[model samples]
Target chain A: MKQWFLGIGLITVFFSQTVQAEIVFVTLEKDNALAIVDPIAGKLLKTIDIGQRPRGIILSPDYKYLYIATSDDDTVKIFDAETFVEVGQLPSGEDPETFALNPKGDRLYISNEDDNLVTVIDIPNKTEIAQIKVGVEPEGIAVSTDNKWVISASETTNMIHWIDVATNKIVDNTLVDPRPRAANFTADNEQLWVTSEIAGTLMILDVKTRQITKKIRLDIPGVSADKIQPVGVVIDKQRRWGYVAIGPANRVAVINAQTLELEKFLLVGQRVWNLAFSADQKRLYTTNGRSNDISIIDLENHKVTKSIGVGRFPWGIVSKP
Target chain B: MISRFFMNRFLLKIILVLLLGHTALTYAESIQVIKIAYITQEKKIPAALSNLDAFVQQKGLIGAEIAIVDNNTTGQFTQQSYELKKIIVPVSADVVEIFKQQVGEDISLIVSNLPRTQLMSLVNLDLAKEMLFFDATTTDDELRNKQCQDNILHMLPSRAMRADALAQYMMKKSWNKWFLVMGMMPADQAYAKAIKRAAKRFGIKIVAEKQWTHTYDARRTAQSDVPVFTQGVDYDVLVVADEQGLFGEYFEYRSWIPRPVVGTQGLVPTSWHRTHEQWGAVQIQNRFKAKVGRWMGEQDYGAYLAVRAIGEAAVRTKSRQMKMIKDYLLGSDFALQGYKGNPLSFRAWNGQLRQPVLLAAARSLVAVAPVEGFLHPKTELDTLGFDQSESACNNLNKETLPVKPLLKGTYDSENANSYQQIIQQIINKIKQNF
Candidate 1:
């Protein structure tokens, strides 16, 4: 096939550059594989067989292991990041879509979307610690840097469940815009940011007061606001910029971190779902689900520099140091 | 249905825990409960058609109850709960007194599944002025036109919308020539009128038109009647107008000419169907089936949408006041996701909820409309229902007519009064083109 030849040609062209770049892991959702990309060379270095419906991919705080949430198998498989071989497995609940790592680096808060529960796993013991019942279709899990609070955003209930990490119980809940998809705490833990996919608004909550400080509507000149579904978000504290992957709009909205103002809508591949920043935060990699490729963006240039073909329906991404 | 009644109570608690956070258990006792009343007439169905009916004895009442459960599931987290006061009045009974006695002064929102005549009578009562009624049953166009009730918000699609939806799908397939068949019923006659209007609007030609005057006879005479009934018509499709299931189903394989049947027959246009399994509809479907033990019908969906609208308004506004909720419902920002792939809103000119109609066959979904290429300046859904610029419903008061423009932020901040006049002229120009 022409596509196969095109991919091989791209790999050869990419191999001529620096070959010992940081590895970027991308979840090939439909292919049941995890692709390792050499970011500096812009080549897919290798792909390891993951389980069925592998969605969320993240590295441990010490970067020793890679944890992948295999939704269909209902288990988080831990792989040795260097050798790319299976090392361990965590007990994830039914249909785990995503998970968050605590700052202490020994706890995993996993979101079981179908079960409507946030399953907490003790990494050292490799056992389920607690199951905190949340709202319907809980998708996003974010843990505060202090490891005091765990927040889970539900898609159907359209609210963020604030769980006290000490008690493993819901301390409070705050209603956001419709179809809340993802939540993240600011690096300083001063504020909490939540994305409402259907409402197309990024809501910021004051951490101390737990009140909505700002609601920023994402709009591109040519793109309809209805199609601008804000799903994945990653904030770079150093650069003072937050990038939001607008689903189906094929663009990442760059926002000024302090002002919460949308600065630019950088067009990427089709149906961009998730994003990741490199160790130096110099480049951003995005998983274009529909286009079946990963777009590498030079953050300094504020444009997509190159696109490397991945597997079918690439969903989540993470970068190695 | 009877066995599931007790099961629903236990299931609802589990659902509440699953849908609401653990806050529901901690703050269970202190939550504020918003009361909603559901009023429907207890009409008898013909014994012949009873077997085919999907609804249990509760029908629309069950849908309202399911929505109340959902509301409470979300309500617990917000320190708000919901209660349903269901009233099923006997046929030919005084609905106004039943409504007044059941609702009293506590409930401000009423979900009505009554007949058109009963609804009209109830809406005329002095007590109805203070309450907002959600019409979930009737598809009568007059309610959105000549008999438009300011307090009544329609959840079900108008007959015109259904016809237009089918017309759009038919137009997409280039099935321009139609053979119109009508059953001898008053509701069928109104549906035929709607179809005719849709045909004219969508540029379809009615090659032949006929009426089904023959009654359903078990004596084998009905079979002889249909072949002759559908003869001599050379049309691409047969559009049947049968509100009640009198004889629409019999025309599928018995027609003289081999053509597709649409409208209320072989491939029908509806607000909801069992086969519409897209855009998270399956979640609601599974929930409804678990509680009601039957496929969710159109009437059930209508009632579900009505209660969900009230729930959405209450949740969004965080207020139980009737005035605030009413303003929010009629305002621009009040959009409800009715599992129709789009956020459904209301038409300001008339109180009709603008939504996409489902074109479905018996076993699967056929299409959803407003179809591709049917463009609207504002929303594609506006192309299906009566648009504000072209509707005959001029019931909106002139003073408050500018409310929509103000809500949409389309009016010029400077020269507000002059812009109202200019907007009127622009609307009139749009009417001429339609």
Candidate 2:
């Protein structure tokens, strides 16, 4: 009952400075809810009970719907963005940890971390499209901006499986660093960026050949090698810089996208997991699972400006204009 | 009590495909099918803690079946397939002769769940020259020490590894002083020796040692008798060495000082447990149950690791030859995930796989060990088992190569800004108790 009153009190405090506010969506892994915050207001607006063990969260291209991988529930729970109503579920194969939405937002690609398969679900019809087999313990799924290629990075196999989007068939495999965690293509769909957790490095690949072009080794001045686990990878829309969430090192590595060199590490909260660019591409938000907060970074200056405490184990994060 | 057996071989021809089997047809790619043989000598099931022997489902070979399904799902993308052939030798048959005749040139990979004597002789046979063996059942330290062979890899944690894992956790919990209870069986004696080795290695002191010689049924009078059995020199925890489920289960709650019981039973250290659900372990647990319709046992998990490790090696090297796969697995590059937080790898000094042992009770996971502060220069996993410097095998050369730090950066040991492990423990305790 005390927590219930605290939730309502936070909502009213968030209502005072709602001017020019952009809403941010954060999935609370331990609280089993979705926390909505007004980044401009620097306060949590409200939180809705989402689902069980919600982790991977994303908004559709048009920002009409929200998809969350409610892992324990074994379904990707979809919510209507505006109304916050439970819409339906995508047939996420068991233990869906991470997923990707195509640029068209009509197709959703989800990695079944248990089944070692990628499940594709059509958005409009709300039906299963296909289940494409990948590698063992597959995670960090992404579809190219062109929607022509979808890559699944298998942590154990350490290979990125390239699937032709049209046929939903794996066409090729590229060997990578040990325990590859996440992969993404450039905004132009020309270069592929990948993060290796154990190797503590970010790999960039040429899309034409699917071969590694540069392997940027991350080095924090005083941090131990084992503590520098790199996980999520994100680059701004302009392709000016790239940031990799260095897990446990509690920092986001800034890399000059052009030269592909490690610039510096921006310190954040403890166990910083995933990263998301603001809708305007001017700021970045990081989810620190251990700290139960999201650190806001002013991308213009590469500085951690503020941190807002959210629900327990605050995991996946995204933003709306 | 050897009974005449009739069944000779069980073959599983799994050609799994999804969605009308059209994925395979559309790809029109060459699928490489790798054959693996599971050879085991038939043995009697040991007594369990519970009295429902009839209710427990047989789970020896089911773990390999689950692995085949998992391997095939990944193989669908890599154009590689896996097929398993099982042969459980009965008392009436000659195990070596059957293995030499049946598992021919076609199948070079084999996983065995056999006794120490049988496994020792089996891996030493001339027929084992070309093939690689995966020992999934036996935990005898001799196989990892004196009887170690190049062709065979021990997938299960050796008795020493389990003891070390427990000692690490006990040290982490500040349960440094221990009262030891030894059981009657030979295996129990071997376990007791391993526990002593662990205590000395981890700086833990044993305060008292006693022999469990009572043979009467004490289940009903556990509360009355356990206190007397556990009484002697004040200790932080009672560590039992009952390997055959004799009387260790009764010590958890009924100890003389209301202390926690640990070791082979009670809060035991294991490679896998049903109650372990962290680090995506729930995925494999649920998948195993969904397929086998039963709980995955410890031995079952060992077999699962064997099959999946081979699959990982094969797919990574893209080869079916035993030489390539063996070299890749023993090499420093091999990292197989056993659903533990860290990637599982093989120890260079011995073939035992280095993994974090799960410390669990009957219904909950207590902690994962190679605990937080037990530091090793190479990898934290090496701290769990016999390191390269402590290896006793003559056949294996002790390679003490230091891993090149990924970056030339090092934080001050005392002031690292990392995930606070103490906070994690508090969080885990809250979740566990609630």
Show pairs that collide, candidate 1: none
List, residue by residue over A129-230, the lDDT tens digit for candidate 1: 899888766887899988888999877677888899999999888877777877888888888888887778899898887778999989777665456778
Tell me each candidate's RMSD, in Å, in order. Answer: 13.7, 15.2
Candidate 1 per-residue lDDT over residues B1-434, each given as its tens digit: 87796686566557544534433333334455677888998877553422565535666877787778667767878667888888889877788788778778767888899889889888888888888889998899888888897888898999999999999999999999999999888999999999999999999999988988887663453468778888877899999998887778778878887888899888999999999986558767877887767888888888888888887777776656666667767777776767765677778778888888999999989998888778877878888867776677776431222122122122223222333555566556645865
* CAPRI rating of model 2: acceptable
Lowest-scoring 10 consecutive residues by lDDT in candidate 2 chain B? B8-17
Instruction: Tell me how far the alpha carbon of residue B206 in candidate 2 is from the true structure, in angstroms, after superposition.
Output: 1.2
Off by over 4 Å in 1: A1-53, A72-89, A112-116, A169-172, A222-225, A289-294, A305-313, B1-30, B42-55, B90-97, B213-234, B245-259, B361-367, B394-434
A141-246, model 2: which lDDT tens digit per residue?
9999888999999875678999999999988888788778888888988899999887778999999998888998786876655577888899877788999999
**Model 2 off-target regions past 4 Å?**
A1-19, A71-78, A87-97, A155-157, A198-200, A216-228, B1-31, B52-60, B219-221, B397-434
